[model samples]
Target: MSIIPSIFGGRRSSIFDPFSLDIWDPFREFPIPSSSDLSNETSALVNARVDWKETPEAHIFKADLPGIKKEELKVEVEDGNVLQIFGERNVEKEDKNDKWHRVERSSGRFTRRFRLPENAKMEEVKAAMENGVLTITVPKTEAKKTDVKSVEIKSLESYIQVLIDVLTAETRQNRVTPLVSVYEESCYRKISSEFL
Candidate 1:
């Protein structure tokens, strides 16, 4: 006979839900929490947020981790590319007489992974924690220079002409004209300055 009572099981929902806002409370005059606030709280409960920066020599990462001890944190590189930061925070035990109204602080294991760039030096990575913040440094490898040596050259025809002049001078001095074969001339024609 009553659809609303049957659907809701005769129990009113809190103002956190839009459908439950039908029954307003005069005592509850506080503003409703926004979606952004909920998201921020959720992120805070999960992995700590990090800031990444690239410098001339290295890549740096800074993560905010409040109320976490240095012994609980672990930083490592996996598969030569992934940088992993993992840690855990335990909830403090309450006394027998104390009552908790709300528990918003997160207490669990959290992990954050980042893909390192090609130039990052995985072997030389360093990490430090200070003032509730963890900082990681990944140095970059020095660039390699080409080892190829350059050679100078003139035109192919000019090179052949100089050879001919040398041969002519030798022939004149020796009174013997060394035979210049047609094959040699053909080979010289096919040769280019780039080869030299």
Candidate 2:
């Protein structure tokens, strides 16, 4: 009446069981692996990771591509704001009699993109690869200085009206009557002098 197979139902004890390992064993030691220990094929399958830094003159981008050749990598900018990086990693050749015990290394194509800031100078961007690391530089455009200007008032009436509106708002919020009175007296004096 049982639907489960005999191999699946039996209680078994073996060295391969994951739960059998002793966590507190004093003689057991585990070593951490470094980036250099990984095969090129394994590292290429991962998406390109990058670091971005901004300076007064330019923006810099550094990407990790340990096993990729400069000829296989590409860098591009689109619509002035989008930055793209892509590349491919070829798989190693295998012999007819060789057997793969494990395949932790991955081989394929990968790409990464970023949206640049408004100040980036897309036209002057440059890219270079050294020691399997890609570095990109995008210069920033100089900021324009703002100019202050004085507008002339053609008529006294319009000038008085603008002053009154500003004073009204100021009086309502801060009860600043002295400023309004001073401005009103000065305007009246100027108008009277013009008429006389």
Candidate 3:
């Protein structure tokens, strides 16, 4: 009730507070969660939404998993290139004259992982689900093509005889100075007459 809602936030709910619905919900702490904190992680599958795509012969993944099944979902690859996906969800039997208002779906158990690449081909991976979407696929290998080499450029009097042999090896350690010994003897007779 002071310091301006503790320096600008969290203090505006009083029009005689009848469960004040002043509505500002900056992510109301993870969507409609409460019914004694209805578990299943407060809303599972919906957060399980995954996606990754890359074609040219495979490496796709998708997930949504509503009402999970296929024996309650699970897929794996582990270590030789990690890809695991997990599952679990069970939160519905709550009677006693069921009154609940809003408990935002989520029962429990969910995981996802991925790492595969090295032209993946993990024992021909594949999965499918449909109508709640799962679909996976990973097959790819055979990508190695590189070959380009070309070089040979030397002229301008062999770069003025390598800049007159690095200024006559740094002016022969501080002594040779008749205009750099006549520009290193006319750049060593024009690079020994352009290699004779």
Candidate 4:
């Protein structure tokens, strides 16, 4: 009697061999997408990214931090110009242990720091955390001006004397003298203002 091949024992061939594919064609024809690109396509409920901007008067920082708690977050100044932010995220199964067949949520620590401009005022800095996001702002210090007062010249004599002194000093110091010399020539002069 001839025995027929058992259906279960029938030989089967794999559609594609992994080893053969690797050896035959090592280079991937299609480019792989990066984490940033993948995250951008997803909704905020799934992933979040950071965004920031700066203005002449202040610097603003904003970050998406959904599903996080105030107790898990911390903000501190590392130095005069460093702003640091750190936080931890923990996701546990709400139901009893066995009911959770899969855990896909991410859990870890997140941190970021910013190096502020020299004019930033640490004392005036402020931060707020709300709706799973954080925003921080630091104001810039006002610009300063020179302290010297203006000198009034009523007569051409006084003006010429002043101009000579200015030109002599400028030329001796290898600084620009054309401005002082022009003023001196336009106004008639007699004696050196310093000696007189």
Candidate 5:
């Protein structure tokens, strides 16, 4: 049982196998899931894939629900903003003589919820299922625009002239004032930034 096939194919690898040119994955016991598993989380508790889009008129959602009937699906809106979509597709039980070679086509129940924006018109929300796809559209209202007033940009030349005049004035003795150090640091930063 210790011997197993390497990821590189027919090559056999064991615990004592050298690490060069051969990679031994520690999590090999768990097999990588198939594409069906990603789209539908299998029979136990299926979680289907859903797509959402927004347009000028409404917010639309498309859920992939292959081989599902209208009677098997449920769509609801809760608390005004949460849109819920849930459903299940169960296969009929067969006799002992009948065997299922592959069971990836069936899936169990799964619930998915989406938080709608304030502009969503939940009361008028509509859903339709066609061609293995469930599409839901939530009409939207015009959002209120906030009042934004632009401020005028004052001329910086006067400020720069004042700053230059203050910096060029003679200091009291040889003492390095805090303002002088600040100006020096800012000048150094500006010079360094220009080079970069």
Candidate 6:
């Protein structure tokens, strides 16, 4: 009924042992498998789902971590821009004979990380878990203007192409061309006729 893994005990032998040939031994010396690897093999592991919301003042994240105890949960802020939530739930069953038809739920460690907004205030962050829902609130910090910027200059080639496109589109409609395009075309035609 113990949840811990069972350990088998046996005598060790060297290759020089005459009576007990270590080479013929059933249990060969090998490195013990790590507990993390064993935990990964276990079929029961927890899965967490998360929901995010953004507001003008703050961004909120609501995560669903079912079957996990509050004591097992860990929450922390990382890298000044990320909030990490992780936890593990251990379920021990004494009845080994009972058969399980379907085991869809996870039962191990679960984690969820969220990126904070640029204006997020790390000091005012808060988290609460209720009914398997973990809600993390990060308040928005006041944004300061980095530097004064100038307006981008439009390329003359693109500007002229845009003007031609508008004029072409207006002419394709078979209706009267717009006064702006007509004036522009007449001006260009007059300049070209004078040059010719």
Which has the higher lDDT value, candidate number 1 or candidate number 4? Answer: 1
RMSD (CA, Å), candidate 2 to true, equals: 14.0
Task: Give the TM-score comparing model 3 with the true structure, all chains together.
Answer: 0.27
Query: Who wins the lDDT comparison?
Result: 1
Tens digit of per-residue lDDT, candidate 2, span 1-196:
2323347534344467654343463322224334554655455456577999999999999998887899888899987799998888778899999876555555688888889989999889899999978999999999888897998855766676677677777787877876776787687678757864
Ranking by TM-score: 1, 2, 5, 4, 6, 3
1-196 per-residue lDDT for model 3 (tens digits): 3224535556556767545435566655665655656645545553687898989998999988877776788899998888888888777898999887556666677788989788999889999998988899988998989897987688666777777777777787775675976867776787678775
For all candidates in order, the CA lDDT equals 0.78, 0.76, 0.77, 0.67, 0.75, 0.69
Q: Write the per-residue lDDT of candidate 5 for residues 1-196, one digit (tens) a residue.
A: 4245557656554456553335555554335556656465564346678899999999999988878887898999999999998897876778999855545455577789999999999999999999989999999998789999997664554445555556555334435566785785587567556654
Each model's RMSD to truth, in Å? 9.8, 14.0, 15.3, 14.7, 15.1, 17.0
Per-residue accuracy of model 4 over 35-134 as CA lDDT, tens digit each: 6544543434233456768888888888888777878877788788998888777766485555543333456676777888788887788888999778
Q: Please tell me which model should have the higher TM-score, number 2 or number 6.
A: 2
| Span of ten consecutive residues with least summed lDDT in model 4 | 19-28
Could you tell which candidate, 5 or 6, scores higher by TM-score? 5
RMSD of 1: 9.8
Per model, state how many residue pairs clash.
0, 1, 5, 0, 0, 7
Select the stronger candidate by TM-score from 1 and 6.
Answer: 1
TM-score per candidate, chains pooled: 0.60, 0.54, 0.27, 0.50, 0.52, 0.46
lDDT of 2 at 15: 68
